[model samples]
Target: MSVDKRKTIFDKLLGSDIKAELLIFFHRNPSFSGSLNDLASKINKPIEEVEKAVEDFVKLGLLNEVKHYYFDPEADKELQNLVLEDLTKEESKSTFELIKDVEKTNIEVLDKLLPDGFPPSGLILILSDPAAGKDILSIQILCTKIAVGRKGLFITLDKFPDEIRDFMLEFGFNSSVFEKENKLVFIDCYSPQVGIKSKEKYSEDPLNFPNLSILISRVLKELNSPIVVFDSLSTLLQKGGVRSSLEFLRSLTGKIKESKALCFVTLNRRAFHPAILAASEEIVDGVIEMKVEETEGKVENYIRVFKMMRRRHSSSWLPYIIDVEKGLLPKT
Candidate 1:
């Protein structure tokens, strides 16, 4: 917009990416390695571009060379700057910058366009058809959090501990990662023993979310990560009707709003009513729809941020897919 900006390539570049597109993408996927091949396949970017881009990235100290693999690039710098160096007031500008950035964002996730960070702290809904890889999506998000040593709270209305463990093992996530990292945690809201409601009023406390709120709140207070997800809203509302579902979700959203976590709720379109969906619309920050359809004469999977109550929405569905060994990869 300015003559001076047009004259300078760096100046034009500074504000050109006025928004945080690349940062948000990596934030959504922190655990992923960014090897030349991996980054090319995962981002649908050209291999040569990835190599050139990452070479500049490493030279800038924005990324680290790890076992010949490139980190999220914005890898945690805070922990790395642990050694304290005495400083005086009004030192060199570089020294000032280094001292101030003691809490380095070593996360390979956030070092995108900005040297700062983009924190995802809001509500999200992931809706898909039954058996359409909803659980896999949840696992991907969970693994992303764990990769950065951040904790995850999975409030499941569907799967049990053993069931989830088995699922992750299929994707090469070892049980030690869960236990040692203490990253992945599950709140079994699906159990009737915790107030799921049976003939005798579901385990003594009838209106309780079957310990759903309790576990979620605890995780919120403890987790250092920005990501949190609910397995499936369908099961939470399974015993209740549409009105009850509306009330429960409304209350749940209110509770989630009080926390400092970015949240997501999974749903099946057929399992929910259109009227209830409309009623619960106010509490949602955004709705992301996942679908598999024939595109370019092939079956493709996509994740699109359809609506964002707080910000402008992405008009297109970003396509993504998973391979047998590589796991979830963003297609477009």
Candidate 2:
């Protein structure tokens, strides 16, 4: 007779096919705690193997042994009740409250880029090639919101908060005033990478999607009608794999929609996989594509609206100039 060796879901979780099967059996028959000989017979395994697996589970804190019977201590009533409470709790807001009027939310540079103003509550993707002014444009858009008395949250994955602050100051926008007034907040996702402790709401591990989601949620809950800027999505795509990055974006967008806040996420067009880029574009409300052109001896920057959902937008690419004194200015 040949023994079966098919992998099960528990096998993946426990890293041992036989142990996973035993765990499943125990879970199914929660009250059936038995001796090693009985468990070995029930699972059709050697008594020694059964004993080893049981001892492993006990060491891992998944099971407990009392008077020669192994059982799952996590199946206790108090823990079960806590899990049920989490599963049954109602969300703070409904779907209808998430969607907002796109016409009323006005972003300064965005208004000039799109025929209509910024959307009220959705993700906006900004794509550009390297050195194409994507970061500068995104910062200018954020500063525009801050200048208009709207709260802004900048999640910087590629640059330190001080670097971003210096850039803003060099471009003639004083970020200190906004920081002092508590209108601008920065979630520093880069400082920890270089052995430096972050002073802001720091994410020690940027690749941890659940941690990042929780941090963003807590911040958004405290603010009202804010503009959230993800400095660059490409960094996240590199840190986390494609699937995890996509899942993170989906969850973040859902939260942004729920809060009725505008989200601006930038991506380096050339750094991402084609499939990942397509997947990201599908989730956003609008897309702004930017590029640089060498004309004669000078480099010129241009931008255009690639797509805007539920709004009339210009598809024509227009030339733009970055002025240190005035920020981004549309060339006449």
Candidate 3:
């Protein structure tokens, strides 16, 4: 006689066999998106029965209720792995765990703060002044990730695509190479705002929050866990106002988390109300702050991690310099 330890664990965690079965089904088919009827047909169960089971899982935090039911990306990892281990017993190891590995942010200084890289669907918020090197840091992150064969989606709220590409060239990142590979995409919100039709395939008015959300959702669906950047989210706040901008950010962050994408959003510290800034900071997984100060006629750049949830980080301010060719460099 043998005891099924895995089954015991699953039963204790889920408390029901149908819930355990659904967990395995969703793990094996992460891309499954259909109605209850469709899922019921595939699972060989009654529609009513399947709907009740799925509703139960959703209420229990195991499933997400979108247009269709799917496994929640933010679900408990240890419990998820335990359920998946039983389902994938034929394999030598679970591919689910491999796919869940953290994606590294390749910036040298920032990598030191985020030693474990980014957790799945990590949301980072950047607060800095115009001259504080925030944009340069973002470009460096995008370029490094793209160089490593990861896809990137740049939401340009403050610059044209050509201007951004030129800026990247100044920092020694050849954006054209990644653009040619179709692994890099730009949403030219800036051009549309200035009454100029953007030549880029994706362009939307910054004030049109719904359309911007739709465009981002479409782009994210085409790429697998790409790095998404909102260069100067302050433009959105300036144009849309605090209430509308916060609503838009809530929707945007929800989409990013559900897609398991790494997102970096930049906000100018001098632009919006402090209350809005505080609210924005509350919505993200981490916040990195930068400042520029002049002392004795020499301007210096400083950065620090203000807050990072569930990660160990040094909050001490670090001196750094923006190199014309190499982007951001730690001051010696």
Candidate 4:
């Protein structure tokens, strides 16, 4: 007789089939709480069998029992938000309406990138090498959106809110004024790593993916037609494995697309695994590849609109210069 080995590890760890099923049930229904009898009836098992499973879970600290009811003690608001409806579609504007709105925004930088402006709603993946000015480019884009009277939410895992503000100020963009006017918000994901408490609108432990999602969802829900910028996915990938990081991005992007908001996520090409980069490219609406080239020790930075779904854009790499007064300038 052939023995099944697939569940061997799980069975040994859970000790019984009923316990494994109970664990699986709680995992699938994280927000559920029920009395022992109710759980047994739901699982279609006898009361005694369910009781044994519940005892095993409680002893292993996987579940908590109080007054004959069992629940996952570790399940919190963050976990609940993580599993929230990611595909809830919002009524997006028509392509024509979106173009009109973009024109009304009057962002010059975007005018240079796409004479027509960004797509109505979609994700843009910004790829670049380290210190190649990816963050600066993202900030410039966000500042332009804000300048055009659009609200923005910047979730920065690479730099603290203060540092970002300082950089923007140096680039001649007054982001602090926007913060004071409530036109812009920053979710500081870097402060916790340095043991610094954040005074920004939203702050979260960068390594806690669930909390990060919850914070993002809260901001997206409150804002209207907001431009969201995630200041580097490579940092997230390092903190969370490729699977969890990609899953988080997929869920977050789904929410962004449904809300019809523009989102830009920076990814360090050298930092990400090739497979991860390829998978991410498939999920976004466009890919902006930034590169720095050195010819005879003179360096030049260029950007290419490698892909933009449902739109016509320049496929050739365009040279760009960083001017202290102008931010990112596309050289003609």
Candidates 3 and 4: which is better by TM-score?
Answer: 3
Q: Each model's TM-score?
A: 0.55, 0.66, 0.68, 0.67
Tens digit per residue, CA lDDT, model 2, 185-204? 88888887677888885454
Candidate-wise lDDT, in order: 0.52, 0.70, 0.74, 0.70
Error in Å for residue 298 of model 4: 2.1
Q: Positional deviation of 71 in candidate 1, in angstroms? A: 56
Model 4 gets an lDDT of 0.70
Encode model 4's per-residue lDDT on 159-218: one tens digit a residue. 888888888888778887888888898999888878988887689986788888887887
Worst 10 residues of 1 by lDDT: 82-91
Q: Who wins the TM-score comparison? A: 3
Candidate 3 per-residue lDDT, tens place, 149-230, comes to 8899999988899999999888778888888888999999998778998899899998888888998999998887898889
Candidate 3: C-alpha RMSD to true structure equals: 15.9
Better of 2 and 3 by lDDT: 3
Off by over 4 Å in 2: 1-110, 295-298
- Return the TM-score for candidate 2, rounded to 2 decimals: 0.66
* Clashing pairs in model 2, backbone N/Cα/C closer than 3 A: none
lDDT of 1 by residue, 94-194 (tens): 22122233222232211211133222456667777665567776676666566666666666656555677787788787755665555666555555535
RMSD of each: 20.8, 16.2, 15.9, 14.6
Each candidate's clash count: 12, 0, 0, 0
